[model samples]
Target chain A: MLGIDWNFAGCGCGVPQGKDVEVGMRGLLVKDFRFALQNKKMMVMLVVIEAVFLVMQGAGSASFVMGYMMMGCGMLVLATITTDEYNKSMAFLMTLPVRRADYALEKYVFSFLCNLVGFFLAVVPYCVLRPDRVADTLYLAVVIMAVMLMLQMVMLPAQLKYGGERGRMVLLGVFAGGVLMFTWGRKVWERALAGSEGLQEFAARMAEGIKGLDAAVAGIGAVLLCIVCFVISLSVSRRIMEKKEF
Target chain B: MLVKMENVEKRYGDFTLQCSLEVREGYITGLIGANGAGKSTAFKAILGLIHTDAGRVEVLGKNREDFTAADKEELGVVLAESSFNGMLTIKDTAAIMEALYRKFDKDYFYDKCARYGLPVEKPLKDFSTGMNAKFKLLAAMSHEARLLVLDEPTVGLDSVVRRELLDEMRRYMEKDGRAILISSHISSDLEGLCDDLYFIQDGRIQFHEDTDVILSDYAILKVNQKQYGEMDKQYIEYRMKEPFGYALLTKQKQFYLDNYPGIAVEKGNIDDVMLMMTRAEREKKL
Candidate 1:
């Protein structure tokens, strides 16, 4: 929410431009687009793959597919976080008028947006395909947020530690490992719960009990995770750059 | 105080950068150093972009640590590298800047951009490196930032563009309240632009003084074969090279000029003075 009031400062196209850091951001964005183009092949490939997965997930109703869609989207968004380094965006970002604080905030906001986009894209189509079980989509969204936050928390500190290319590599490696571990854990828990008929029946009867508990715990946990990850990211980045020979 | 650095030191394992620096309210300060001389590190410390281990920096009567958000708002800074977002247009960049500063003049930014022949619709990526460099300077200077911090703004520019940027900086300084700190490798620009300069070698401020004083102080004596023996050895800073004989670099140029009236003396430029002051540092490594 950049509260931009888009009234141009009276068009003076013929006159000399102004002095300020705001104009610098224009140049920065242009360079960002250029960098995207430079990696056009990979970017196009990623977009296409994401689209294909979303379409396939829309046709599937299995719980495993739902988990895959949510977590997959989270991973897509995670890659964007460090792609800027490949494009050398960090160097350009520093020269602009924007302060380091805002720069760090962008990562948090970006991660959140990516999770929302991924969840809505895959979940909405799935719900439309099967109007009867749309409630599952809500759980899917929650799962999306959790996965994105979890991945960001794991990858963020690495981004700060190595930076640019090396940082992204480490982040990806850790993220991949995390997704595997989390998926394994989720599968094992789901099987264990399903194996106990008594627990499944109890969960169904006490659905209300689980709802309140889930809301309270998940809400607080998400908030705490977001805050901690953000602060640690800011702290780690500040340390790497602080008195750095750069 | 306009700007002051006391007992500032940064360590890079093998080398150490230690110095004390001051900049008067109405003058431009130049930080000079050869490659790996810690000029960039010193600049970063002054901007508070990087935290320093030991020392204090004061700008515009506010200690570097105590300077509030309002104080930072008053300062306009541009470093060797950029600090802006990439996806935003030039127009969007300006809008973001407007929020950060109370003195941000939007009209001035567009006006300067149009004058520079920069395309507002085009992103910074479309521009050449030199064009991008100019845009960087434009962004920093557009804000009525009380203090301007520049790190080698002219390193990659052609002579003509460098001069244009230099003139803009000089115009900024027309207002006595605005101060500038420029760090550059090119000696000529600093020789003419800065009122005061600090020569840094191996991360230390080896010499600091007025340009005019240095100009008139260090004399490159062109002595005849006979007068080499009679010449004042104490005044000679040291030998430039074995075969070329010696050239004296001094703070007391007027003394030699006044006393050795007959001896040929040449003015020592920024590079010459830097070479003289850091000669020992260079030699010890060799």
Candidate 2:
């Protein structure tokens, strides 16, 4: 007969015990980072391609080139999340000691870290070669990071709510809708500006107003908007994960 | 109890899962059911992977909702499917597990991997189905958790590997306060390992008893039409009609053997019990 012990204690596996939320969060980050790092070959290929693009495009449009490269890095972050879902590994991940909230926190942290790496790789070289473009490159990097964050804000929740295949479909639909709206809005604006002197004058005034605004204040506002989006996206992703069946 | 589900309920469109069972420390509890019999659903509910409509789930003496990361550290879980990312090599997986689990025995994990003939440098995608299953089990066992929740952990492994895994489970249970809740369609695996068994059908538990009692007391009575008509209906748990006669399932095997002079009574295994019970449920509906 098998021995039956009702006691909860005395299971001496020599493992440490205690609930350290920081350690749990760190564990989740490490896991996600390791997962992202497994694509080192792909990252290297992207770096080689970016180097070619930088040399061909020249330093005149360095900020624009760097911003485009960072965008690809951001997409890699999304790809890692999608890959986890595609492999059905999220089920295993959730069973670990980490909470759903921690998983969301780790994704944002991982994405931010990847973006930082991309920024350094792209901007540092340009800054070293052309010191005059430091401020411009820095500003462009921030804007690119903000845009990437917003894109992830939309993608993460959709991916968490739906699986990979359907999630990609949803992302495609959003992108298509945005392109259609942009094209239609641009056409309307052109028609209105061509026909109406008052409307064109108002547009010119708006552009002037934007240019006249303090750069520091605008930067602060952009950072605040990104922070707000990050918080909301994390909350949405957490809720979706909590409700997920598998 | 290491794990407890009290009146747990989950509903998806028309199918409902309503189950309650307990797994005590230092014992192996087997959950036996046919495919799509809500066995997996019950396991998910206990793990809080799915929202339960009503009832409480308690693990390691605390409500599942209140379970902290520390509590989870003491749990080892293996789902029906491969859980590791296929893109990762075994070395990468070991790194992840070491980070995720504080007590993860890295050496033990690698040793098991080597013993199982799994290449550590290759990505998991290169592993065969049986290799993947063994890897998941190895990962779970490497954690030294107090409770192990395994769903179909031995599905794709050969007989030799399956027996080795079962031996490992027995060794795991030898530790005081260690328990396992395992669900599998393979009845023979559970027959030798489980201390208690729970038979689930539709959405509810049809039977929960000690494995010894199930094997010793439960039986199937083969009878002709006249004997079946005369046999007491109270003792028959489930009945299936065949062209020859009827196979009647009953818990009171000794009672029938003593009462009936020469009725064909054969010991019922887990499979026979599940089939007869499910058939009986369907027959009742008809």
Off by over 4 Å in 2: A1-20, A175-209, B229-234, B259-261, B284-286
Write model 1 residue lDDT over B174-201, tens digit each, in one string.
Answer: 9868788889888899888999888887
Q: Please give, for residues A1-246, the per-residue lDDT of candidate 2 as tens digits.
A: 022221212221112234444556777666667777877887787677667866887677675677777876777767777777756778777778876666666677778888888878778777877688788778777777778778888887887777677988988998999999999999998998999999989999999999999988898988778877877777777667666767
Per-residue lDDT over B183-238 for candidate 2, one digit per residue giving the tens place of the 0 to 100 score: 98789999999999998888889889898988999998999999988878787888
- Please give the TM-score of chain B in predicted model 1: 0.91
TM-score result, candidate 1: 0.75
TM-score of chain B of each: 0.91, 0.96
Best by TM-score: 2
lDDT of 2 at B6: 94
The top-ranked prediction according to DockQ is 2
Provide per-model DockQ scores: 0.14, 0.32
Q: How well does each candidate superpose onto the true structure, as a TM-score?
A: 0.75, 0.88
